[model samples]
Target chain A: MSMLKITDLNVYYGSIHAVKGVSFEVEEGEIVTLIGANGAGKSTTLNTVAGLLRPRSGSIEFEGKSLVGVPAHKMVSRGIALCPEGRRIFQDMTVRENLEMGAFTRTEEESLEMRKRVYESFPRLKERRTQAGGTLSGGEQQMLAMGRALMSKPKLMMLDEPSMGLAPILVQEIFDIIKELNAQGTTILLVEQNASMALSIANRAYVLETGRVSMSGDANELLHDERVRKAYLGG
Target chain B: MGFLTNLINGVSLGSVYAIIALGYTMVYGIAKMLNFAHGDVIMVGGYICFVCMNNLGLPVAVAILLSIVGCTCLGMVVERAAYKPLREAPSLAVLITAIGVSYFLQNSALLIWGADPKVFKSVVDLPSLKFFEGQLVVGPINIVTALTCVLIMVSLTLFTSRTKMGKAMRACSEDKGAAQLMGINVNTTISMVFAIGSGLAAIAGVLLCSTYPTLMPTTGSLPGIKAFTAAVIGGIGSIPGAALGGVLLGIIEIFAKAYIGTQLADAIVFGVLIVMLLIRPAGLLGKEIHEKV
Candidate 1:
């Protein structure tokens, strides 16, 4: 069943139409990926779904309920969490505090359980729980960002550019974590500039270009597609 | 004996400034706006307490509690009405609007209460305390004010460090967009910051009026500026920095008034700020922020 469905979404930043009539769906327990080059509106689409940006016109239905005009904070309570682009973790706060912030909508008992689960998934986070977030290495920060999002116990977790600026090995590790998370029952909607790695793990893929979804299909088919190879795979 | 008296007086006054400075620091930290009207909130708090205690004939404790509630609401109202609409506007625009609010509050007080200063009756009626074979003396107000400030500082520290709402506040201060994405209500968090800041201002107001015993439209102006300076001195966004700055500013102002001429006291305070800024631009307790390109 489709957990999140977006239909004919249009988003604007000032006069520029950033996401123009984009539509997509994330099925339950499937890893869906949006891949594109810079300025392709992939982030914009993700943000719109997360309710960070209001669409000019579109229908966003999460669990069959319309999400138009819903505030960004309310999205989390609705079981949708976005790990925003650039891993915007609170630098001044401790790692534990950042994770705690992720459980803002949750009760104390639920938060404690979530914290234990997050710690289990990312042992490094458990080790560095007392350290300030800003002091963490880029890879650790990325992990913390994802871990922080996980603290919400989201059904549909949206990750934007999770591998940006990381070493190849760290990037591989992040993808592994992503795949592991998907296998563990979190429905994932990923936005990425690393088309090759993203397509490898995704069940389905959508190619966003200049503010619209230009191509989409089974991830495996798109990986071997000549058009995708020529445009995104640097062939 | 005179030195001891001056030390006690400085600490008592400094504690009041510290309380007020907490308001400035917290509001600036979370909202990223210097609420120029914060000082006026102090005046309004004083007025509210006055009306409740004198006009309404409520108990002192009840009057003080009502003043806090009044200020907290006022702070939230000010944020929603004046600041929220201009959230995305330029900092200068917000600053100007804050100044406008400050003037509006001052003028409103002037129109309602008149320009003439009225004597404020002391709420705490405890007799003075003596120590060291009656050589050293202390007013009950001084002890109460100092202890209250310390208690408040500790409680605020615990609140910001331990509570979920406090963590949300810290997150909001760091990144509003990110905080919202985390399912933390950014609007509610901002309102909470305003409420906390204004509540602190109300307490400072009552303590200040108790000592100084004067009520006027501009009652909070000087102390407000001093508290702002204190916040900047300690570190505008750092909580401990604000407290430290307030105490240092208080001591400096008191010493200047005693030894250096009264006219040069303000000058000395500003001069100290200048020197401190020159030495450490981030203020004393403020963490140095590296701008990410």
Candidate 2:
């Protein structure tokens, strides 16, 4: 059963139709990936789903409730969180403060428990809890991003380009973290440029090209498909 | 005797400036845009409170509370009408709009309240408290002003450090887009910052009126400029920095008037800004941001 659904979603940036009638869905506890090169509306699609960008038209439903017109803060309250691209952590804030901010809408009791769970997931965050988030290494920041999202206790987590600009080893570590997060029953909607790693971890994948979904299928089939092979998989 | 008296005067005046400066700092911290109209909002608050107490014969406490609420709502209106539309626009455009709003508020006050100076009667009448054989005497007004400033400062610190909204404001200041993605209502946070900052300025206006007993429509403008200088001195986006900067600027101005002739005081105060900026471009506490590329 689908936990998240998007239908004919159109988002515009003042006459620039960024996402043109794009649609997809993520089943509960499933890892779904959206793969595209730069400017393919991958990030735009994720942002629209996260309610950061109000759709120009179309519907976004999370667990049968329409998420359209809901503000970003309301989205978090209703169990949706986005780890946006560029790892935009609060630079002046301490590591602990960054995580605490994720639980901004939660009750005090839930926040405390969530903090402990986040610390356990990323022990390095615990070690550097006092340090400013900007001071963390690239790999540490990616972990911090994932941990911060986990603090919100969102049922559907959207990660945008988590592997971008990281070393190969750190990229593998981030992918492994995504898999682990899914294993723990969190529904994932990931947008990535790394098709190989994304498809490897994803249960299903969509191929976006120039503001529309060009193709989509089970992860293994798309990984083996001829067109997806030449265009995205670097065959 | 003169030295002690001047010190008291400096601190009292500085406390007022510090309150106003906090408004500038808070707005700049979160929005990264100077709400040029912020000082005029204080003037509006003062005029409203003055009319409430003096014109309508309302009780002083009631008048003050209404003025605060009035200022808060006015601030939210400014955010909604002026700042909100320009959120994604260029910084310069928002700044120009802020200046335009400031001018509009001041002129409207001038037309409504007139250009004449009006007296702001003291809310409470208590005799001075003396210390050291009367060498050091603090009046009830001065004591209240100092204590109120300290109390507000402490509360502001606690709010920024301990509260969830405060944390979100700080995060938004650091990176607005990221804060939005984190589920913070960036628009609401910015509006809250404007309200809190304007509220602080309103308190300062009331306190200033009480101390001086007279207020003009444009009274908040000069102090606003001086407070802006204080904000720049301590750091544009730093709260503790603004307070420290304000007190230091006040002391310097006082001493310049006392020891160095009043004529040179203004020159010296401005000269200090030039020297400080040359030495530390980021102001006293503002962090210097590095280019990613």
Candidate 3:
């Protein structure tokens, strides 16, 4: 069984159909990228999977347990965490406090261990542990967001626009960190507008457009495809 | 002689205001709700203690405990019924709901306790102690009030900083949606915030009643206003800030009344507020975070 699976997931924002019967799955310890333009329902799909939005119709099964009505916090306890878009770190809280909040569901000792692990992954965060999250630079804030999500000690992690608003150098570093995290046995589900970068690291990838999965296959295969080259890869 | 006595008086009075201010800070921190009904909750607490002592022949300690419990439940109910439904509603609606709830509680207390003011007997079985050549006398009520406020504040600080539930509350304060995503029950956390805040308010009420020995339908209004001012003065969502603001306000009130006269105290308080607003809009302890567009 896959670590995470979505079957005919449909979501709505009042009258607008934001995710129309989308389906995908992530096996354990693999990177899956969902590439799309703005308004392609990329965020909606991620939000639904994270249990932030209740899907209007569809089934989300994580490790064989249905997640249709399960709340977002319960999803975290089930070893799934969402590093939401825009790096929504708690602005008023210190970096350490924001990270601590991620492990709020776990026991004290485990959470402390997780915090140590997160700090190890981003040593810069350790240095700025006492600094308010809002005070960090854009790249640092992104690292904080990822570090915070990892503090949950999840089996599957979903990231939305990890490279948005970052410098090119920081973007490469961020992607490198993502790969390192994935290599360390964390299953990843990423949504990105940077199709080239996402496809480069992703083991498998899907192309989404206007609330539907327009294409899916091996990341390398999609990268070489003619239509994908022009529309996504900037070839 | 007058200055020293006033200083002591201010610190004691400040302690009472600090107790009341905790409710405002806690509720505002977690739920981001101003909770205008908090003052009335204090009044309700006093009435409960009074009834338990006078009508039911309960001991003062039991009456205080029962009153705290009752006020905690009252705070919870207000959060659920008055604020929960309007969680996503506009600020105006919630503000109006708060006012309505405050009025409803005040009227209910009037109906139950009548329009009479009742004196609360001192729980501390000791006389006043004098300091500085009889200029400063430390009364039992004042000492008790300060001690109780410090105890509650310390526990509250420990709860927020060290305990799991307290961290959850802080998370909710920082970001409600994200806290909910972390599997913390948002509603339950909110209820806990209200309970703690209102419970503190009840303590303040009991303390004030012991000192002033008076209870009326609108007993909580003046103290409530003072506490709200303190919350703003110290930074609304900062816990330690509220306590500092309360103490500062208390001292100012005492000295202004002692040196200048009681009439000048209100003017001086507002003047200080204006200066604070001009200097730091976020209050003394609050750090501002700007959003990137």
- Which candidate should be chosen as best, given DockQ against the real structure? 1
How do these models rank on DockQ, best leading? 1, 2, 3
- Model 1 segments more than 4 A misplaced: none
Q: Per-residue lDDT tens digits of candidate 1, residues A67-156?
A: 989999899999988998999999989999999999988999998999999999999999999999999999999999999999999999
Spell out the clash pairs found in candidate 3.
A73-B181, A73-B182, A73-B183
All candidates: CA RMSD in angstroms? Answer: 1.3, 2.2, 2.2
TM per prediction: 0.97, 0.93, 0.94
| Model 2 lDDT per residue over A1-235, tens place | 5799899999998899999999999999899999988999999988888777889999988999999888777788899999989888887889989999988888889889998998887888999999999999988998898888888899989999999899999899889888998899899999999998999999999999999999999999999999988998789
lDDT of 3 at B23: 85
lDDT of each: 0.93, 0.88, 0.88
Model 2 docking grade? medium
**Candidate number with the higher lDDT (1 or 3):** 1
Which has the higher TM-score value, candidate number 1 or candidate number 2? 1
Alpha-carbon shift of residue B157 in model 1 (angstroms): 0.5
Top candidate when judged by lDDT against the true structure: 1
Ranking by TM-score: 1, 3, 2
